[model samples]
Every structure is written in structure tokens, then in C-alpha cells.
Target: MPKKRVQVVLNEDIRKLGNNGDLVEVAPGYARNYLIPQHKAVFATPGVLKQVERRRQAEQRRLEAQRQEAIAFKDSLETIHRFRIERQVGEGEAIFGTVTNQDVAEAIQEQTGREVDRRGISLPDEINKIGFYKAHVKLHSDITAEIEIQVAPS
Candidate 1:
């Protein structure tokens, strides 16, 4: 006998299946046992599908607004020459301590009036000297921007 399949609306994003408010087909057993029990999905009846459409529309609007904000932030970063971070300098031009991702994120937030997650900042190498370095900011999945960071003695 052919495996039973059912259509449902996802309440949350699932890696391989679909995103929240998406209509998807899955095995009946999986949908009833896992998705329904976990409150991750609901049967795609006409009424529920209408609700899902509304939710999807709202989510799209929110995402679009975020993308626009991200684009403006990227433009601001591109216009900036360098972001200065002050640290104690040891003998020679070496910094007393390493500059971490959190340091970079904080500096960006201070200068740009925007908050960036430390995980979104990509460092090419360990910054252990009082000098200049480039850090890549992942603003969105499809958008990235590079910023010049200057480490100077306090």
C-alpha cells in the first residue's frame, strides 16, 4: 500500500520542509505524531490556510523592512573610513590583549547606532597588534559589508 500523506501548515521553520506559515506535505504518521503533537504544524483546512496566508504576508512585510534597514546600515559602513578601537599598547606596536569579535561588534554599534551580533562579525585573523584590520559584517544572508578597524594605543 502507498504511504499516507497529509498537507499541513507549518507553525515554525523546519530545515528541509518549509518555513513558518508555509503549506507543506508530509507523511501522515510524521505529521500526527511529531508535528501536531509538538505544536509545530496544523492540518491545512480552508480556514487554517487562510490564517496561514495572513501570517505569511505579515512575516514578509517584517522581513522586507529588516532588509531595507540592513541595506542602509551597509551603506553607512561603506562610507566610514575607519572605526577606531583604543587599547593598551605593549612594547613595540603590539596590543596588550587580543581584539575579539565582541569588541568589534560593540565598536560598530557605538559608531553606527545599530547593534550587530558578535557571531555576524567575521575576522580574517587574530588581531594582536595596534594597527589596521578589516572585518566583514554579515548583515543578511545575501548582504555583506567590510569595515576598516584601526587599533590605536590608549
Candidate 2:
């Protein structure tokens, strides 16, 4: 029988994950030749296993700091700017057409000077009605943003 050790980088935040971190079980050859060499992480030796505690703590602190900063930045933005869109409407108050990500990107660019990706700017599955809406901007895997959109007669 053969036994080996390996370390896994937490793709998601580690705070929620238990202290027993997810260690990618792999052949020692692959762990040494590929994963560890790539800096993906280290082999779970006694010393490295000891680091999980510190590393998790450090990651948690960093995540919290980043979250706080994002909140503060979002608050500041709320006071100064909001992303808005304009569209043509029909007599019945229904939007004549639709609003796509490009429209939202351009609106954000024009309003806030922030170049957001259309893919990153998510609209309703189908935004055909004339009204205000909210779009989620995936700032990070763990962080997201919402922007106010105003649809009016174009």
C-alpha cells in the first residue's frame, strides 16, 4: 500500500469551510511534479498542515477587509452616481423593444466612467417592460454589485 499528502487551495473563501480543509487527494508524483510546482499549493506535510490554520485566518481577515472596503466604496458611489438607461416606450407604457448589456455598459460608462463588461452586467432574463430595474455586477466570485437602471421613452 502507498500513501501520499497534498494541499488544496480553497477556491472559495475559507471561513465557511471547516478547519479540516479540502486537500486534493492525488498521487504523490502528480502532487510533487505538477500541483506543488505550480504553486497551486504544497504537499500536506506536518509543517504545511500546520499552516492551514494561519492561512485560513489570514484569508478570512483579507476577505473581511476587502468586503468592508467594497461596502464603503459602494456607499460612496451611491451618493455620487447611479447607472441609468433610457429606452423607447409604447402608448401602453410597455417598452417598445429591449435593453441589452451593451446599453447598460454604455450607461455605466457615461454615468460613472467605469467600463463594465456586458457579460458582467446581468439584466433581467428579458427586460421588455418600461420601468426601472436592477442589474447585478459580478465584481468577484464572492462579491457582486447592483446598479439602478431607469427605462423611459427614448
Candidate 3:
């Protein structure tokens, strides 16, 4: 017999299934053995579907607001010509410590009043010297901006 399939409403995001409040189809065995017991999903009954729909609407509105904020932040980020980081200098223009992605994220937050995850910042290379460099930041999945970073001797 063909494997049985069941429809479920997701209560939380599942990497393979779908996002929270999404209606998805999966094997009955998987749904019953894991999803239902774990409370990650529920059978797609009429009532459950209605509830999921309401949650989806709320999630959509929140996501839209976040996207707008990200866009505005991107605009502001583009306007920034450079960011300077002061570090102790040694011989041959070498910095005592490296300028890391976490440092870049903190600098952006301090300068722009917006928080950025360190993982979202990409450095062209390891910053071991006092010089100007370009750093790319992913504000959102679809929005990216580049900023100039100047490492200066303190």
C-alpha cells in the first residue's frame, strides 16, 4: 500500500516541514510518532486550520514591519562612508589584536543605533593591520550593505 499521508498545522518552524502556522502534508507515521507527541503540529481539522490562519495573519504583519525597518536601516547604512576602530598599534602598522566580525557588528550598532548579528558581517580578510577595509553586512536575507572600516592606531 502507498504510504499514508496526513495534513497538519505546524505550531513551530520545522526545517524540512515548513514555517510556524503553516499547513503541511507528511507521512502519517512521522506525524503520529513525532509531530503530534512532540506538539510541533496538530491534525488539520477545520478548527485547527482556522487557528493557524489567524496566527499566520499576525506573523505576516510582524514580518512586514520588520522588513520595512530593515529597508530603512539599509538606507542609513549606505550613507555611512566609513567606520573607524581604534586599536593598540605595534611595529609595522600591525594591531595588537585583530578586528573581528563581532567587533564590526558592535561598531555598526554603536554608530547606527541598530543591532546586527556578528554572523551577518563578512570581512574581506583577517584584519591584523591598521588600515581601511570593506565589510559587508546582511541586514536581512534579501538586503545587504557594504561599509568602509578603518582600523587606526589608538
Estimate the TM-score of every prediction: 0.76, 0.51, 0.73
Q: Is candidate 2 or candidate 3 better by lDDT?
A: 3
Error of 1 at 146 (Å): 0.5
Q: Go through the candidates in order and give each one's C-alpha lDDT.
A: 0.89, 0.67, 0.89
Model 1 misplacement above 4 A: 1-6, 10-20, 24-43
> What TM-score does candidate 1 reach?
0.76
- Worst 10-residue lDDT window, candidate 3: 48-57
RMSD of each: 3.3, 6.6, 3.6
For candidate 2, write residues 1-154 as lDDT tens digits. 6686445543232344323455556566865786567655555667665676788799899988878876764554455445667777777787866888898878766766766568877887877877778777665456667777778776
Output the lDDT of residue 137, model 3.
89
**Most TM-score-accurate candidate:** 1
TM-score of 3: 0.73
